[model samples]
Target: MIRLLSIFVLCSFSLNAKSISSNDLRSLYSKGQAHWPAIQTSDGRRVEPMSLLPVASPKPEHVALGDKLFHDVQLSRNNTVSCATCHERDKGFHDGRTTAIGIDDQVGTRNTPAIFGIDQWQSFFWDGRASTAEQQALMPIANPIEMDLDPKIALARVNKDKSYHAFNKSAFNSSTLTTEQMAKALVAFERTLAAPSSRYKTFLTQLNKNPQHAINSLSDSELNGLHLFRTKAKCMTCHNGPLLSDNQFHGTGLHYYGRRFEDKGRYDATQNPEHIGQFRTPSLLGLMQTFPWMHNGLFDDLAGIVALYNHGGVRPRPRKSQLNDPHFPKTTDLLIKLNLTKQEQADLVAFLRIL
Candidate 1:
C-alpha cells in the first residue's frame, strides 16, 4: 500500500520538461514533501531527503575505539598527525587549506574533502578512487605526503596500546587488531560526522503542515534563487538528489593539463584517457561551511565560485605543442553559459547558503 502511494505521488509530480515556478515548487513540496521526497527535476530524478548517517548505530564500544584510533597521532610515521588534523570537527571536516598540508608540511595535490555522508557515497575521494569508506580510512595513513605510516605499522601501534585492548575485544571480539579492523573502526567514527541538520530541513517539515507558512520561511530572493537553480542555473544536472550530488565525475576545465598545476583527476585512477580532468561531483550538504571550494580548493569566495559557473566553468586552452594531442582534456558540455543576471547569481548563492 505504501509502495503504491509512492508511485502515485511520483507520477503526480513528473510534469516533464515544464517550467517549475516558485509556486509550483512550493505546491509540489507541500503535497509530497512528507520525507522531503518527490521534488522531481525536469529529468524525473527525485530530490532525495537529506538525513544523518551513522557512525551512529555501531556499538558504542566500536565507535569509541574508532574515535580513539582516528585521533591517535601514532598512526603517522612521525607520530605528529592524525585524521582530525585535516578533518576537524569544527571546520566542517575540512582543514581550510587550498590543498591539504600533510606530514612535515608536505602539500597534497587535492583539497581535503569533507568526510560527511561517506556511508552514503558511491565512491570516495575527489577522483572516486576508493570504493568504500573502510578502504578510504587506510589511505591517508600510508600516503607518504599525508601520514607516511604503513597500515601494518599503524595497526601495530594500535595493538601495542594497552588501553585499546578492551575496545578491540568489545568492538571486534579480538585480542589483537588487524589492518582491516582498524580501518573499519575509523570509518565507524567518521560516519558520525554526517551532514549537519539545517533550516531547509525544518522548512520541509513545516511545509507538510502549512504550505504558505513553509513558503514564508525563505526570503523572496532565496525562493527566486531556488527557482533559478532548478531552471536557468542548471545545477541539477550534476548536483541533485538527497545528497545534492550526482555521485559521478565531470571535467570542469580546471585540469590545467601540461601546466604546473595539471591534475588528471580520475584518469590517475582509471588510466582511461577519457577520464582525464574529471573529478567527482561533491555534495553541497555543508555548502556554507566547506570553503575555499573545488577539488583543488582554488576558489575562496562563494560569489566568485558562482561567477565561474555562471560563465559556464573554466575552459583552459591547449598549448601549441599539445594541439594535436589526443588526450587533451575538454570540459564537459554539462556546464553551459548560464547567462544568469547579477541578481540571479546573488539569489543562487542565497539558495546555496540554505543547503
Candidate 2:
C-alpha cells in the first residue's frame, strides 16, 4: 500500500511540472517571440528606442518669463504686435492666414507653422535655415516687417517695467538683461512645448506596452486610417516616427500662383543644386488648427492639399526629384492619380486632423 501511494504522488508531481512548463511556453509565444510589436520606422529601419531619448523638463522661472515675453506687446517696436499676435495660443500658436501679416500690415511670404511639438524638430523655418529654436526665436523679433525691434531696444523696454524687473531679479539674479538671455529663456520655454497626451500618443503608449493590447485598443476607423496612412497614402514615408516628420526637405512641385519663384528653399543654405525648390517637411501635429498649407501658403484648405498629393504631387515627372519621392507614391506612375475615392479622401483628411 505504501509503495503504491508513493508512485501516485510522484506521478502527480510530474504532471504539475509539465503543466507549468506548457503554460510558460504559451505565455512567451503569445507575448514575446511570435508577437512582434508595431514599431515606427525611418528608411525601412526601426526608429531609436524611446527609452534612449532624454526626458524633457522645464524650469518654472523660464516658463513664467516665457509666458510674459510671449504675450507682451512691448517686445514689438510699435507695441502693437507680440509673438502671440502671429502665434496665438488659442489657435495652436499659429495665426490662421494664408500668409502671416505683421506689425505694419506687412505680409510675410510663408504661413506661420504651429509651434507645438517644435522642440522635436531638428531644424526650423520652411527652408530650414535656422538649426535651433533659440536662433529661430530671434528672427521674428528682428524681422523688418515682423516685430521690427532692435534686440537692445526690446531688452530696454522690458527692463523699464517694474514687474519685469522683479521677475528678472528673481530669475536671473541681475537687474540688467540682454537679448541672448531673453532668447535662451524663450527657447527653454519652447522646449517644454510638447503634446504627449493626444489619443494617438495614448495608442502608441499602449502599443509599446503590448502589441496585441494596442491592436485591440484601436477603433475600426482608426485602424483603417492607420493602414491607409502606412500603405496606400504613403504618409509614413515622410511623416514617420513619434514626432511625425522625417526632418527632411522635399519639393512637391508646388506652383505658387502658377509660377515658381526664387524661394530656392534648402538650396540657398546648402548651395546644393539638387536641393532647389525643396522645403523642410513640416510636422502634421495640430493640423486642425494650422492651415493655409505649404511653404508659400498657396493652398487655403486641407482638401486642396490632399487633392494635390492625390495627383502624385503638383507636377509629376518621369524621373523623381530628390525630395519628391517621400511625399508621392512610388508604385504609381500616373501624375496625381491616386484613384482615392471621395470617402477615402475624407477619411484621410479626418485622420490628419486627428494628428
Candidate 1, residue 196: the lDDT equals 56
The C-alpha stretches of model 1 lying farther than 4 A from their native spots are: 1-56, 205-211
TM-score, candidate 2, is 0.74
TM-score per model over all chains = 0.86, 0.74
| Distance from true location, Cα of 110 in model 2, Å | 0.5
lDDT of 2 by residue, 104-207 (tens): 89998777877766567899988888998878988888888899998778889888888787667766877756787788778767766655235565556666
lDDT scores of the candidates, listed in order: 0.74, 0.60
Clashing pairs in 2: 311-336, 312-336
Q: Using lDDT, give the best candidate's number.
A: 1
RMSD of each: 7.5, 15.5
The digit string of per-residue lDDT tens for model 1 on 264-295 reads: 99998899999999999887777667766777
